[model samples]
Target: MLKEVYGNECSSRTQVYKWFKLFKEERETTEEDPHPGPPSTSKKEENIEEISKLIREDRRLSIRGLAEKTGIDKECVRQILHESFNMRKVCAEMMPKLLTPEQKESRMKICVDIPNNIDIS
Candidate 1:
């Protein structure tokens, strides 16, 4: 009946059966139950601040080193660095993934200088 009414827009028969069973059982909401696990705070403001401070103090610090120093999980440290701080590893050192205005200007100057400083004649 669902396939006839909704055609391809209808969900699979198994899913429809599951929902039907739930509805018949008087389930109030269709939402899935909350997942069971310890809550995560690795990306909390305090942790971000600590991670940022550590990175600023030693931009060469490896993710493993930061994890050890801060006692945070390595994966969490990596997420905080990449997602929150917008940084990445470059030549074994932590560096901003994107260039700042000053860095951009400096890079432009270097690129411009190569042509002017060289003898094209």
Candidate 2:
């Protein structure tokens, strides 16, 4: 019946069945329920700066140690270390993942130079 009305614009049969199941189970709307947990705040700029300062002052701190010192969760500390700072572990110490801005620019310059050097004709 929905396909008759909406043609190719209708939801797939699997999706329609899924919605039907939700409606049968007394679901109020298609909106997802809020996940149960404390709101995340450990990745804020202040936290990142603080972590950077801490790491600069002491290079040997582990993720657990950082979390304990700063009161951020261990996972969040790990994320800030890996994602924000672009760092990874080496011999139990955090080391940079090694892509400096200058190096990246050099690579991009080579890419641009390649097209300019090539001749399609």
* lDDT measured at residue 6 in model 1 versus the true structure, 0 to 100: 45
Q: Residues 34-78, candidate 1, lDDT per residue (tens digit)? A: 322223556778989999999889988999999999878899999
lDDT of 2 at 63: 92
Which stretches in model 2 have alpha-carbon errors above 4 Å?
1-38, 99-121
Model 2 clash pairs are: none
Worst 10 residues of 2 by lDDT: 30-39
Per residue, candidate 2 scores C-alpha lDDT tens digits across 1-121 of 9579646755677666666676678665544633222235678899999999999988899999999999888999999999999999878778788868997898799999998999899
In lDDT terms, how accurate is model 2? 0.81
- How does each model score on TM-score? 0.56, 0.51
